[model samples]
Target: MMMMQKPLLLLAALTLCCCITSLHAYRKRGCHCIQTTHNQVPRKCIRKIEVIPVSGQCRQTEILITRRNGHRVCVDPEEKWVLELLTKLYSENETSSRTNVSTNASSKLDA
Candidate 1:
């Protein structure tokens, strides 16, 4: 029984590692992308980024994004629309976190 459990545990760990590795593949930095030409169809992918943590600051660090059709693309990280979208996401997160903290504090005080 104990031997069976050991293998099961190892398998679970391996599965988790594989999942994490695959997730990182989808969030790859500096993906080798071809230069776009006028003839190709445009991808409908939305930009996503892995915000890097450095010196206690969170910063947009890459051009990884996905399409509605599950396709991934590496875009120009410094594009104006990309920056605007990142800023919008960050602000939304900040406000939601503040609201959560305030709600938790009020509940604790009422208890």
Candidate 2:
């Protein structure tokens, strides 16, 4: 009975250690946003933004924006400046598109 108890305790200890190790391994990794630019100025510097994780690991999320022109933008909730910049960019893009459409329609009407 004593030998059996010793084996059971050893197994329990090993199991506990394995569980702890797995938990540590599963922990999230931190990440920061960086800017890329086609020209001299780095996009990050112009944007003045860095992304931090709001929940979980930053790498685990797909928090980046890709422009049609092949520009990459990072997204993170912790970076309010970046968020605002993105919002402005979106608004401007939408406005420009709308204006172009309106201009085309007007030209068609004139024709």
Candidate 3:
């Protein structure tokens, strides 16, 4: 029975290691990693770039950010500036869409 118990313990250890390795790989694959060095601060140094949906891939879809002058910038997604930009852009898009819908409805009523 002692030999059987040792094999079971060894199996459990191997299973734990496999689980840990798999989790690490999953997180690495799904995570949006910032490849920039730790010292870069584009948010503080450069201005915020306006996100235009119709601009036709002004940036690749991978959390790309830009400076105010329409130049590419890299920043952490968690940064305050990135959050503010996201909020501002979302609000503008929402408002503009609402305006378009209202105008369309009003025009149909007029006709």
Candidate 4:
């Protein structure tokens, strides 16, 4: 009985340790933003924009903006200003890509 109890106790300790390690790993990979702000930041002050899509690690989309002052802000994705900024950026990307494609095709034709 004593021998059996020792092995059982050892097994329990090992299981607990494994569970804690797995939980720590899971927590490390989850959600970059703790909260999002609704205040509208002027475009001139923004230095960079990062849009992280929803994935298995994060449950929702995250928009992180870096300011010229070197501060990072997480903005609510659903805010009206945020939506408008995203639309403008996306359209600019589309236009830029189209221009690049057209230029490439023309250059190839000339060659």
**Best-matching candidate per lDDT:** 4
Per-residue lDDT over 1-111 for candidate 1, one digit per residue giving the tens place of the 0 to 100 score: 998999999999999999999987884343233432222223334433443222212233334455456665545545666566667666676666654323321111110
Model 4 C-alpha RMSD to native: 10.5
lDDT digits (tens) for residues 1-111 of candidate 4:
999999999999999999999987865576768999999989888887777778777889888888889898889989999889877866676666654323321111110
Reference-based lDDT, each prediction: 0.47, 0.47, 0.47, 0.76
Predictions: Cα RMSD each? 13.3, 13.3, 13.8, 10.5
lDDT of 2 by residue, 1-111 (tens): 998999999999999999999998975645534543223323434423222334454443224444445555655443555456546655665666654323321111110
Quality of model 4 by C-alpha lDDT: 0.76
Off by over 4 Å in 3: 1-34, 37-62, 67-70, 99-111
Model 2, residue 2: displacement in angstroms?
A: 3.7
- Each prediction's TM-score versus the true structure: 0.38, 0.34, 0.32, 0.62
Q: How do the residues 39-82 of candidate 3 rate in per-residue lDDT, one tens digit apiece?
A: 34444444543222222323222344444566554445456655
By TM-score, the better pick of 3 and 4 is 4
**What are the per-model numbers of colliding residue pairs?**
0, 0, 1, 0
Instruction: Give the distance in Å from residue 35's predicted Cα in candidate 2 to where it truly belongs.
Output: 7.1
